[model samples]
Target: MRAVRSIKGRLGTAAALAVPLAAFATEASAHVKWFCAYDVAGQPRGLAEVLCADFEWLTGLALACLMLGCLAEGTPLGIALLNALDRVTTRIRTDTHLLVRVTLGFFFVSLWSLGGIILTPELTTDAAWIPWLQLGLAGLLISPRTTPLVGFGIVFLFAYATAQYGAFHLADYPVFLGVAAYLILTGLGISVLGLRPIDVVRWTAAITLMWASVEKWAYPHWTDPLIAAKPAMTMGASPELFMKAAGVIEFTLAFALIWTPLVRRTSAIILAGIFVSAVFEFGKVDAIGHSGIIVVLLAIAADDVRAAASRRQVVLAPAYYGAALAGFLALYYVGHALLFGGPAELTGMPVI
Candidate 1:
């Protein structure tokens, strides 16, 4: 009775602690979600180059193609494509997972639509679900199986369309092959690696940190625009340090999540904040803001994203991964010293 009572009290205490933290995470993750669209020129892209670079434009072009396909294919063809997609997705038989995924994707897109129109500077008032309604129209083409092909075909067409753009470089055609290659590899990686939630959290955190770190490291001026754009960034005590420290913190936390269980719990809590910031920071722009919303939706569904492990696993895994992390960092320290001159995990080990 004493031990049981002790356990209950501890549980109650832990729950109490978690409440404020959870609220902080949610509020931090929350962006000024727009409920309508604006017609402002040049306001489409955010301050981040990721919001303006190939990734952003390509996504926009792809979505535009999805729009075109819906227009070209019409309602019947869309339904037929969906039915065909259902058949294809069933082959792998991850329908339950895929259903959850697509629904989240839909929900996030809708949220983005709401945010896009509400925050945008140009559109009158009716464009609330603009991109999302387009997404909905295209959603008809979104059967698990067919959605892949549809998404692929649309992206491909966009790339092809863009070959005629920008200096009219006939040479640019080969460049697209690399992009195509990346998409193929990405699709495969997601299916193969994302089978486990632990893998998802670890890799996503690592990737996010790496990407964030590289932008600042490569260009000293990189964060100036970011700080300028996010009013909240200014509020952070030492925004510059906050930016740099956030990168290192994420990198370390990602390592902890993968290798240390106790740290995983702590790191997961922090990462929840990191991801929300990433989403809000990204989502404020034209293209990626919506993408951020989509990712957030995915995060919500993948219960194991920051999920708790079994008690037994928790007891054993943290120490194992922690020890592993020490060795890995040591190895990194040496390799960086010998070859790269010094450890740039802080600034030099740039994002791939």
Candidate 2:
């Protein structure tokens, strides 16, 4: 009975998390939106509320990890790791276009098959046209000449979903826009601002992860049911502490995605592993929903672009991470407060 309900829970109407317990292992593990009603415009937990002692310690540890990763970037082991990664991903790097198209082709086709889904499992729609649009997008991926059309199609879908669901709710998946940009830029064979298509994708993926991590912090209670249902996920830690550590780990690793080559590639690989690991626990919903980003991460992992890393850059990474972390935290909390009202006292775990 427990297993049956768990399976049904994954397929239930997507909302948002609402508990004070252990949460999803990674941002991609369980979209809080999938299982419970979420008041996106509701008052979020204030920054003051979330800065508990545990949060402070976990953050400090995360900063240490970032500083160490930066130092390692200039070491012999880092160079060797990069070389080994390069050798393994040679074909993937060379055929990034094919990989993205093939992955997206299947992704859209799956959406078409599922029907009613906007972009993921939780965000559903009644419009009959949506599945057809997804099907059309899948068809568009078959030809390089038509790939630009596919990009435009994705933009339309994102815009339409934003209109239907509101921008804040839709904001959870900027990765779609990143995928669109990659398709459009690669298809058109033009470089805007001298940035490679893959680099654009990498940046957007980083942004998406960081933003979701903030959601984990602001709405830790939203995932309490998930934690309660899957207590083993907490690894014997209290649910609240587990959620805090998860958020810090997620945020720190996400920020690393934009660091030096060694750091970013390693971050990509670790993130990919985390997402994949989630599939075993959450099953097909996670696997299908996360497939596109997984492919993107693999491409990033294989990318051979060696940006010249100097001592100055390595020395400044922790500073950048701190700034980015502070900036995102402010954005999420203040944005919610301004859009909603003042922070309200959180109640008990919400009944889904």
On TM-score, the candidate that comes out on top is 2
Compared with the true structure, the alpha-carbon lDDT of candidate 2 equals 0.80
User: TM-score of the candidate numbered 2?
Assistant: 0.88
Tens-place lDDT per residue, model 2, 1-352, is 6654543463231112212211345533567777656778776676787888888888888888677767766566567667767887999999889999999999999999998998888889999999998999999999988999998898999999888878887778898998999999999999779999899999999999899888888888888878778777787888778777888878887888888898888778778877877777777777779999999999999988987667887668767877998898877766665555554432222323
RMSD of 2: 10.1
Model 2: how far residue 190 lies from native, Å: 0.7
What's the lDDT for residue 279 in model 1?
59
Give per-model TM-scores.
0.39, 0.88
Error of 1 at 325 (Å): 11
The pairs that clash in candidate 2 are 14-34, 15-33, 16-32, 17-222, 18-221, 18-222, 19-221, 19-222, 22-239
Q: Candidate 1 regions off by >4 Å?
A: 1-104, 107-142, 145-147, 150-205, 225-236, 260-269, 277-352
Total backbone collisions for each predicted model: 16, 9
